[model samples]
Target: MKDIKDINKATVKNKTVPTTTGGGVKKVIYTLSTIQRIGLRNSAKALTSHNACKACGLGMGGQRGGMTNELDEFPSVCNKSIQAQSTDIQPAIPNALFNKHPLLDFQELSGQEIEHLGRLGTPIYKAKDSQHYCEVSWQEALDRIAKAMRKTPAQRSFFYSSGRSSNEAGFVLQLLARMYGTNNINNCSYYCHQATGVALTNTIGSGTATVSLEDLNGCDVLFLIGANPASNHPRFIHKLKALRERGGKVIVINPAKEPGLVRFAVPKSAKSLLFGGTEIASLYIQPSIGSDIALFKGIAKAIIEMEAITEDFIHEHTKGYDNFLTNINATEWQEIVECSGISREQIGDIAKIYAESSNTIFAWGMGITHHTHGVENVEYISNLALLRGMVGRPGAGLLPLRGHSNVQGIGTIGVKPVLPQDVFDGIEKNFNITLPSEKGMDTLACLEAAYDNSIDFALLMGGNLYAASPDQQWTKKAMDNINFKVFLTTTLNQGHVNGMDNSEALVLPVTARDEEWQATTQESMFNYVRLSDGGIKRLDHVRPESVILTHIAEQVLPDSQLDFSAFRTHNNIREAIASTIPGMEKLAEIGTSKEEFHISGRLVHDYNFNTQDGQASFITHSILRDEREKPLPYTLTTVRSEGQFNTIVYEQKDSYRDTDDRWSILMNPATIEKLGITENSCINVRSAHGVMNDVKVFPFDLPNSNIMAYFPEANILVGRDHDPRSLTPAFKSVNVDIEVVERQPSLSTS
Candidate 1:
């Protein structure tokens, strides 16, 4: 048998390319090359266009011009922004794409390959028995979708939205769903940051970042936990570097020692990029997977022992401090160390750094929220922040590093399974229609319901639902069980093909946010709304998402009290949003006034919170313990590559990790040695849900007994088990066993 190293030798080398720093000269070259690949003029136009960034939710671009951030800083672009623009500006997909390729053939393509197939320019539909999709007119597609929705029961239909869409589109979609008599409305957040929302709301009476860019600027220390902003949110690296330059401390806590977190070269800084990059993390801590609560408890214990707790803040601005303190004191240090995989000395050292900082910001990503106890993890993080009086104050608070640019906006505009009572009543009062009062299913519930043959129709507005879901086989089966499914997309993804089997599905081509005809608004993670001045359409056949949604609403609910046809105009929808969604009144003037504004009541700069008593509450929880008899010896955490965003694979190689293969797992050398496996050997990784066979293994700088792999590809090994509170699947921590498929000679021994 051929050696696995010979199959993908470049990936097996496991070398750090050009040192450990991220976004150096390589990023500049990549940006210029991307611009060359897509026409320079198109790239320039897209970059300079007045649109919110389509990448992470760090809030870049808008009225300040492209490549600018919320702080009005110029030339703030990153590789993520460039890649997204290049993909958007590509020429329309060949008119004969659907005709030339069968549905089954498309399923064989990887996420990156499908993305490179170019943008979807026309509406296409596949019949249940059809082997290929055929192009259909917009009218025919809308009519068919309306017909299906009209016949289907409201409870059996679910409306889902992706974060890539505009706030106007999200608002209109959710409104249509409610008007159609279903509260089964959800967005992609349920799979990503829903735990952050649930935890923050319960603790501080708000679900978003309490601090803004200004707060980040003034922070004395940043506690970055379970997040790699260097790869996912490159613009955020600038903040870290700036904070470091000002003598601020950065504490990073994760199982893997990410190279970018250690050091990163700011692309905009010539001296930093050409020279050695700026130091980022002052201290890096690695703990066991699924042990965040224990680590946090350790920190809390250390803080209490050192008398670092803010007694005045806890007593006056917060509640439940006494009980929380009791639990922290009662918790034994031995248990904390055993569960966290960190020494007591190290935990105390971390607490010391946080305790010394007068103002600290607690920021996290999916790594903190992708476990069975995801909500508890977030709550514990909040607990630490509250202990230091970090929350509800300037330059300090909880910041969930949201992935998509408009994901926060989507949730803010009522695209959820349940709406707040005020917003629910306001929608009814404004539209003169009574919405369904029944409880609705979330994203997971919707899929499970469909799998059980209880759901008949699904409308997904802009996201790869199949690739983003856990337990790939189960998600596929659930999608197939649905009678009809509609996907509004700008480009092809695995979901377009693999998500459906026996179901009839429609792929509707929609214009991107930058290509829309009407100006739209998007809210950033900081609760700041920005206006995007839409540009000329790249494809004539494609329509705006708002327009399509309004047309479907018109067809589905004709003669309804709400004037659906009027909503086809984006400004009308904005007016409706301003009237319904509290703190969104600024959206009404955003279209004409061109004034971007922040939504009120989200950022908590003062001690007062939105709770009934106007004080933040402390939530206490015992550290999570896994007592189950495990079938696997190692824990697996699914992570995104530097070349990828969410489930979309912009590139197959991860330059930061220096790996050229996506179908590979990163294991600690000690674990590989203990398992009697050599580097570059092919192995089968099995989890409770599924198995991935013949995967190449590479040694990485992860903690012992823990392994890392890229997401979506590794998503198959992730189980359907999710946090009971938030329902977010445990993507970051899973019990997996590796079986050797092929043995390769060790390079060192050879």
Candidate 2:
């Protein structure tokens, strides 16, 4: 591991350069440069293609045009959209890529380096004895996968999907797996927002966001917690800007003092870009990692003491309020302050903000869900919303800022280890086949089963399972235990190389959403579905995901009762989805109508919930004092840089943090002084699972004893410990000990 010394040394001395504002002149220049590199015509064509934006789940693009959002606002594009578009329209990967490079050589490449190799245009296979992958015919690759799956017990095979696929592809794949006598079907949500789904389901009887895009317009206060939308969801900044302009307050609660969250310039707005920028957070609160529950309880207690609870709404629309109130009243302020690392006055001030607002929306991201108490974190957020009758009303609800474009859609289409009774009945009745009755394993469980050599086959659609998972070494070992593995993707990632060590793996090239010949659909985070009119294929050999999946199904289960051939076209698959999946009946005619619609019964405009009693429930949890256990020197949290999306590193430099390296640890200046370490000092970070060496330490504006590192690369330090209810890995809060390896001389400021 090479050490990066003084990555931000130059930026630290440059007083003229501003790092706080996001999406100003810098974004405009970056967009132009991207378009120039990809060719103006090609970039424009891909951008204007009638498809949903393949970036964040903010619901941009569709029939209204590619640059439009769900609200029909024009010019809704962001850097994430441009990055995804540029990646898709790139030329095909050369055949020599596999022939010249051995598997070991590919493992040495970075995530961005691997992705820059271009799109996968041909099917490739690697036998167990082979050291390198060789191009193979599609028929042979599919046949090999079918043979392996056919020979293995259905229970021994697991299928996983990423958020990149369309609803049609997700629906077809999950249905095929169930009909093949297995229920081991899951998606990437298990790693990201499974906590949000589980907690929301238990509290409000819905697993998705209760408010729609339009509801954001009516919100008076936006409680942005645990999410840094400026980097992850850049398009959301416009909404925040508009809200602030309308006298609405935006409260940001996070561990790090993210510069983008404090202030941001809207790329589309001239005044914002020309001026200093728009103020995003009216009040920014910094809390310790894994301390969100205590902070939420403190806020609830403050609200109760201030006599701000909506007694009538609680009495009529919710249950267990008394118990919840008791839990809040019992929680001491000293405990909240000690655990959350936030002063009592600050907590009271934020509560006062919420109390004054009539319509408030509570939103969060992976920070809240990527913990051992991930589910409880979400439930407490819900509890806060319910305290003021914020849920099941216009402009007032809970929003889980889903990272992927179609992750929520994949879950809605039944890509899960288990299914609801209604979904099971619908699949059986619609397909005229008896579904499997065995309980299935989630993503982690499947990996564990594979580690034990119980799982023989695995199929991954669109995402890098190895890179997205916790404990990189363990994930690779688990995958090695499987006999056969198949990956359906457009480009190569760390998974394609590191995950296929001991298994006979096949990588099949699939068309990107913009490259699909048939029209597809994706559901946004707001429960709204958008139809993508897929354009011409970028490569001849690459096929639509739905087409490839159906072909495999036909080859594997030729005699099965389910008609695999019928799902060849996206329209046919949509029809099947309409018949089986709830709130998707509109999909049957979406192709002809070109009409996008929100899923029914998901949006909570009224007080009625999907629970048996038609009322929401207030759930309470006791804050664990064990979270303060100091076995390690610091509490490390994994984060994505401004230039990265999920596990894919687009650019190593995090411009927002004024750092030009990804393999560096960020700490507060106070912590650095306490530890007697200088900026850019090389160190070894040790975790319970693994150790990272030659990592440079940079001073950042974070709480003392709290540090931050880029994810996936730092994922090696994360263990398999996860939330008991949602099974989401604790990526946000890991105990780590740091040892200084080498100290670089301080930079000379002349």
Candidate 3:
């Protein structure tokens, strides 16, 4: 509600960065806070440090953190040290290895474990506090995992999957877990997109995006709700920028007005540079955090009042149309306006544009999916899209913006405990076995169980559970309670270095997608499975995830019992994925190109209703804005910044709102004045989960009454019980009462 120029500490127009050797330029904003200055100084220190990049574990390539993006005159004081890190200790790719057969080692995968992993993977561990890791062979590691799985109770055992895995590998892992007896399989989606899946599918017939990335070109109106594509998914900028140039309208809705949502100059575009770049969004709607439900309900109401409803489409392809309309209009306009922090006129205008556009796309980021009603919000969008027949049309559809490439792929592979019956039946028929019918636990359920000691052996496929979960202190303790733990990862991250480890915890190094996996084909948000074979090979001493998982299953249970050897060979596993899932059958063949692979058995991208009755499913629910008064003085909103990826932490000194590491919390100016807090004042943020101390505060770009917090740091403030339907932790909604710390606490405990 204030001028950005006055609030933003830094300006982009005053600074200029290189676009490229030809003539591409990108404008980035930053504040000149002491925190930023110190961070920049420390970065120069680390770039010149003896340590690794700490994010991707890539040895400091001669470039300084230095894989790419290195320049002379820059890093002058720090370049030498960064170059030393990349070339010295252990080469990312040794010169001798480059000359060998594959040009890259098939087993040198220090992978992601090298930097973030610290010193954990040198010889590996049987548990914490081991004297020395006598280097174990691949066979030995596999045997150890297998032996542990067999001894552990199936019900007591639990699985954690990361989005980094491929379809073939994920499918094999899920199958192995189900075959083991317990259906308690959990993937990263439980933390990120589970709500979106539940919400969208119930509203429309399908869960994934209705249109492919290629379909964006023809979109006439794009609604970017609770999303910032520039920092999260840069590739999407190409599509959005193109849409803008075509005279299309883009509406961005969020608690904070992200600069990327308003404008972006793509360094990859040519015509844009000639014209000094086109504007990205036509209007930016700043709403209160966790008020997405209210916002959507208002939009639905407006569409109805505007008479934009496709009456024929609703009658022919959708059910419960009348009821849904009734629920949408059930709420009073004044209440919606007060709750959403957006005007009634703004809501109606966006809906008018949406109903008028020939093609429209609604894309949302974590902001929409990280709440208690994340699923409900997703379903709301789907039903809204269905009303206007936006889905299954060119440049128009529901796009669930996913974090970490191919998290959707894991869903397609059915890693959930509640495997879709049709999917389970299909896979069981192919394998000729009766799969378990029990629904399994999600991330929150698994964590709560672990706290109660329900989980026996826990295996994390690629995430840092201890750090990623809310109520960090509690989550960390629960992890330690597990009898056994195993992580299949590329890097040594924060979670790996300081998490709970019982007597049987192990870290297995695996090749990153950047490195070549013999039989792996990665699926993107579009469900496009691309084989990333640079003709490169996995490193020595390391294995592909599929290979590692299958080998472990075989060691624990032989082929006579499960025949996991078939899953060991990548091709066989690919075939298994093809047969088990309806859409994945196309990946049955070997390939080295980006191929359009089917994931859902139902027809999509053309709006063919695939419900049991061959109609789009519609849910009519009244939007209930909890005007509940917060007992606390402040409300905390978590957010992702432009510089970092989700939980990956690539090291950016400045945040999207404050641009300073010192002030971890960004408050509205009015909120700050109301609370009587000063800049850089230390305080505590509390929610149902727990409380946090020493968090810095800043007046940011958010609306009054909303406080913008960051992840991993603010994650602990969100509670597990906040999730509405899918049991996914609602990280977005947290009412925190902030007050100055009277006296500093002891050094160690948070």
Candidate 4:
């Protein structure tokens, strides 16, 4: 066997503007390099197939066409799409290789090295006290899992899923778990976008994006808060560029001043491709971490003072306007300025811009949702939109840019801890199965259950829970307490290697989206559903996810009321989903027609809303005041690098930030000087949860008294503190103190 280091790592060059926005020659070059690494033949095959982009929730491709979006635009792909495709198109990992290393040895590998361990192409089991995993037959794997399930109570067994799977797979998995008599079903969304779901549902009567792709494009002004689309959503930069060309304004609100968000060179445009970059953010506001509520409240107060309220819209279409206005009026300017870290005049200017725009859209990402007051933050965003009557219109609404591609789809298909009454009734009628009415545990609650030794078994459909969750040590310890764990994945990840400690752990290798032989469906962030036409199977040992899920269901429930065999195929699964999930009725024929359709009742284009009162309501929240007075006062925010996805590092270097080291924290030069520290200084960052010892610090452009660190690495320092309303962890607003580490002298021999 070849040593892992013997294989050449893909060389990536940072050849674009320093600390920049998006669109550039570097992206084009990087895309090509990624293709070459996966081989041209594989890249062409995978890229030409009708499959969704596994990277983000934008839904860049489908059976409607290859490299096309829901709008049917050709070549709608980005570097993220190429990177994910290349990762999926690689050859399978053989059993002989698994025999070469034990589970403990795999722990020493980095995220990139582990990903390069090749595709997990077969089912492998680690027996009690076994050092390495050995190959197991499909029947044996199913039987063992089923036998284990038969012994464990349904309430003690948890089923978790990631957002990358198809609607058919997630729906079936959740259905099987419920039929087994438990509602302990949840997906990756709970950790990332649950705040958006809770807050949006309370305000607009809808949890998903309230606008369509057309509305986003037609909006005259876009308020992008707590989102770094330039790095996470590369294709989104193109839309921003188009907005700029049409004289639309983009107001970016984030603590760190990302160069890519400010100005970007659009490679697709001849003018931008040949000359200087296009300016993205017309107005940029840098508020302190956890201060978005104060900033937005200040903006609302200013708008009200200017008498810019849309009275007719507010009177006829919304509730609680008077109370909301009263709260805004009561908020003092001094308190707002001190809390938001922005001047009162600047708040007025932002309000003026929002009031002047006839059409506007409000959009945000994890930054707004990964805080203790995440739900409140989202409510404030909606409050601003309602003040201007920006929602339920042609060119306005709220859009929570989801991270994973089909995360919205998974939630829509009943992969949640609690199902709505209508959805629950629909499922019982359609599948003839009476599910449990008891509320189920969410993702965070599941971890707590495991730690208490209440959970006997856990089946993770996808995602790296160990790395993605807050407080890495706590998560690992909780996972180790589970009796048996199973991971269905395409490649080697940290979860497979270290998430479990018991010998009954199993790894089931499944085909990737583009490699499956059956068609599947995925939902977009805009409530659009796209059918994916699967291509040739890449590995001989691997099977479709639907097949594996069905077989497991059959083994676990010997006499299930629902026809588990019917779900073996994709179309039948869609039929079940269409009948149960609202607005997904079109999904029944999507596999055969290859038609891309939008989910109904989600996109608000009229006065009617899904809320109980048929009118949007103002959800009020008090400005969260930081009462802590600490000597170590810097607030630490976890951020993703341009070359990385969620919990997955494609490249070690952050091309935009010009940093190859992942453990180092990014800080303002002024802040570093004030702290009596210099660039590249080794420091100990202590948070309430834990401490990151001897981490190197780099000077960069960031808000004063704020520091930025890479995620997963910094997740250790984040406590499991979360919003009470929405269990989303506060990964964004962690208070930390930095202490300089003294350097030790070299050894005498040296």
Clashing residue pairs, candidate 4?
A: 20-259, 20-260, 21-259, 21-260
Candidate 1 weakest lDDT stretch, 10 residues: 1-10
TM-score of 1: 0.97
State the local distance difference test value for candidate 3: 0.64
Local error of candidate 3 at residue 509 (angstroms): 1.0
In candidate 3, how many Å is residue 42 off?
A: 25
In terms of lDDT, model 1 sits at: 0.87
**Model 2 lDDT tens row, 150-255:** 8999999999999989999999899889878888999999899999999999999999999999999999999999999999999888899999999999999999
Question: 2 or 4: which has the higher lDDT?
Answer: 2
Kindly report which residue stretches of model 2 are placed more than 4 angstroms away from their true locations once superposed: 1-19, 744-750
- Residue-pair clashes per prediction, in order, are 0, 0, 20, 4
Which segments of candidate 3 are over 4 A away from where they belong?
A: 1-123, 126-135, 270-277, 501-503, 534-539, 559-561, 592-595, 598-603, 625-629, 655-658, 741-750
TM-score of each: 0.97, 0.97, 0.82, 0.96
lDDT of each: 0.87, 0.88, 0.64, 0.84
Better model by lDDT, 1 or 2? 2
